[model samples]
Target chain A: MEALVRPKLQEAYEAVKRALECVHFCILIANCEVKYWGRASSKLGRGQRVIMLKQDGSVLVHRPYGYEPVNWQPPGSRLSAELKDGKLVVRAVRLRPWEELVVEVYEVHLLAHCKLRDDARFEMYGSEGDIRDLLANNPELIEKGLKRVEVERKVEGGSIDILFIDERGRLVVVEVKRGTAGAEAVIQLKKYVERLKGELGRDVRGILVAEDLARGVRGLLVREGLEFKKIDLRKLFEVSKEQGASLTHWLTRC
Target chain B: MEALVRPKLQEAYEAVKRALECVHFCILIANCEVKYWGRASSKLGRGQRVIMLKQDGSVLVHRPYGYEPVNWQPPGSRLSAELKDGKLVVRAVRLRPWEELVVEVYEVHLLAHCKLRDDARFEMYGSEGDIRDLLANNPELIEKGLKRVEVERKVEGGSIDILFIDERGRLVVVEVKRGTAGAEAVIQLKKYVERLKGELGRDVRGILVAEDLARGVRGLLVREGLEFKKIDLRKLFEVSKEQGASLTHWLTRC
Candidate 1:
């Protein structure tokens, strides 16, 4: 099995599926591509958006990462980043909904170190904020509550990882995992959101973040009006070193 | 939900399916009681054996062992030992064939300042071997073999903590990990077994001596045929304190 494609399929699944509906998509799993239609979901052919993101130094995974080259191959998904106006612009997705009804959501902390060099392109979380600032200045991002926030909301007995919030003080709960964004993660997030609404009134909302979540996750997200986000360490480092922007300035701008 | 169950399942699975399959029978899993079915394979429950041995402090596991209470829950498994005659007559289940297939095997060596203490009833791992004895006893366990033995056996691994020769003349592997044992211990032992097989062929046998092992690992062992006999660490300490038993008597007892 190709070790590369599994994560990508997981990302797509996270993007497309609803929490309860995800079990249908994940009946049989091999890497990112799941066993649907009685066949293994192989890698997406060229120009595909689902590409597995492999981790190196400074990443964490609670479970072993799964990849298969024999049956499935990750679709070649590339993000295009171009500074539009003053804010970073991206056509990619963020954490999504309906998926939270199944699995656990981790509180992700952005841990980074800076290494500056000459001219290069850059990004923050693949988009939105500038990578340069993330590397050079993090407090600016953290204090603005743009990158991290503390969430106090319950689901059944478990709590949610708040990803983003709005003026109404509503939460965007997110679940981050390093391996395949599974059906469980989708379902878990959904339940979390539902419970959050009951606990914190109807103003609560949520998202799911991962190295790559599955298609089922996405299906759920789209229907539930949630978001899906993937961050690549390789691309993240590349952007931080090359992009021309002050870390604090870029974070503050976002 | 109970932490003890997962590791025990993993252990019971391996010990039955592989290690002592020719001798013991294995049965019972999770919370399910064994009911006679014509199709069932093993007839005994090694889970009790494992739980019993762990209590004796001859084999170590988690501290505060046993299942958690759920409302007005029933009491979990407990081990109480009674020694009769010269041989330790433990009231425990013999490892069943199917059960042998499940408990994952490990080889380890404890390295510290004392001998095993069965009396440390609640200590996750028992007392250690004496520091002086450990220093003095080192040379004999790891006595260098002839050049041909070294050349033919390829003993160029593991920066020698302690060594012993099993019946097959294979270098026995040992390790002492600080804190507790979990999946990492099982994985490390498996790696060592593979290394010995790959590097020394039929010349190396693995032995694990540690303070404790995780309860969940047995589930992983049942099918892999991972074998390493359990060390009665308490006996080791007893032997150290007594200093009267001959090597033949000592080795046979363990």
Candidate 2:
């Protein structure tokens, strides 16, 4: 379902069929005061709030800014409602891991419901090889005086994305990723550094590169004495073209 | 600010003017393989990967299905690009928490860049007050023969969301949350139950009700000998309306 505008009470009823259904989406607006009775009572004075409902029987009462909802009901709950003394009442109940949600509505302005589609497939983008070629030819695109000495430099452990010689005459092993770098990437880079160090008979610095780094990968890189670089891939292609339509040139040759 | 597609290399260069400039969003499609060289070496064989770049200098390469990217460079990284041997080469470098990303593109299909807007504001939602009112009137909506005897029944510790008498006439103390029911809710319910048990002159069984329960809240409920119930707010509202057009009747009376 796309969207619903202001819905009457009956329309609201039709929107939420059952808790066991796939998923239902509903939005509600109301102006009313509330007080809860349980281990204690909480009183919310007369005001307006928005209410969202899901088909799985989940509900959320949201406010501004904060991520957490003001009130909510978890999924797998039995739901029912009624009106008492002119106020709208809603109730949700569950058996196992039991819970309940009761809402009182003083005024209702809009109730929107929608059904989300889950069968849509996302479009595929490029691949890892494309990123590699872009970075290999333009070693200086990463750092000044950084010269790309070799591509796919083989090591006992694996392969280096680019073998570079910095202006300081130091061997730099470059690891490139076209995707978000994870802890696994850090570990992989460390392995290459170790292998390159033995072959060169000198300390070889390692660089872990990717489009994005995951939450904890950066911290691991620091501990392992490694470096990381971010690349604006689109810029790489753009700069390469300005350097002489290299991509078009390469594509034609390939 | 919107989107740039199939831009020339110069356009790409102009779009990514500086590392410290405002955020930029770039999407690149490439046919590329990737490798990591640091403490180790890891290779991602030739395949398709979507590379995403942000003005914050963060980049992500995505494949399919997985939530995390195969490789990434975090923010605060200096970005540079160049063309080498016909390949589009891109690199990102960072000093503090040092890191780097080197991308070599074998082929490029698309390069899309956009600047996102931050002026959007979300709408508000209904509140805890509504839930409290809904449950207060229809205690049975939570549990059969459960009568809400009082609201915010206070004890020495705190107020309970609801005070009820079950079918067997035993006191049931309920703690309600309009939001996620977490460890805090369990603790709060336990305090109310302990106090209510003393004042009610009989054993008090506690139940915690909320829109949803968080990770550890259930374990806490078990430890405290309390029960949990999930609520579906929309169904509750729907059921209430079917019971009677009470809301409309009340509105008309008002």
* Per-residue lDDT of model 2, residues B115-213, tens digit only: 432222322234666667668776645775577789876677567778888766789987778767888888888888888776656789998877689
Model 2 lDDT tens row, A1-254: 32223445555445544321534444455554444333223345555555555555655554321222345555555556566676666665655434455677666544544442222232223456666776777665565456678989887867888888875678888888876889988999899988888777898888887778999788899999999887655445434332431221211121
User: What is the lDDT for A87 in model 1?
Assistant: 22
What residue runs in model 2 are displaced by over 4 Å at the alpha carbon? A1-254, B1-23, B35-42, B64-67, B94-96, B121-190, B193-254
Native contacts, share recovered per candidate: 0.00, 0.00
DockQ, all candidates in order: 0.01, 0.02
Steric overlap count per candidate: 118, 109
- Where does model 1 sit among the CAPRI classes? incorrect
lDDT, candidate 1, at A218: 78
Identify the candidate with maximal lDDT: 2
lDDT of 2: 0.58
DockQ-based CAPRI category assigned to the predicted complex of candidate 2:
incorrect
* Residue B120 lDDT, candidate 2, scale 0-100: 26
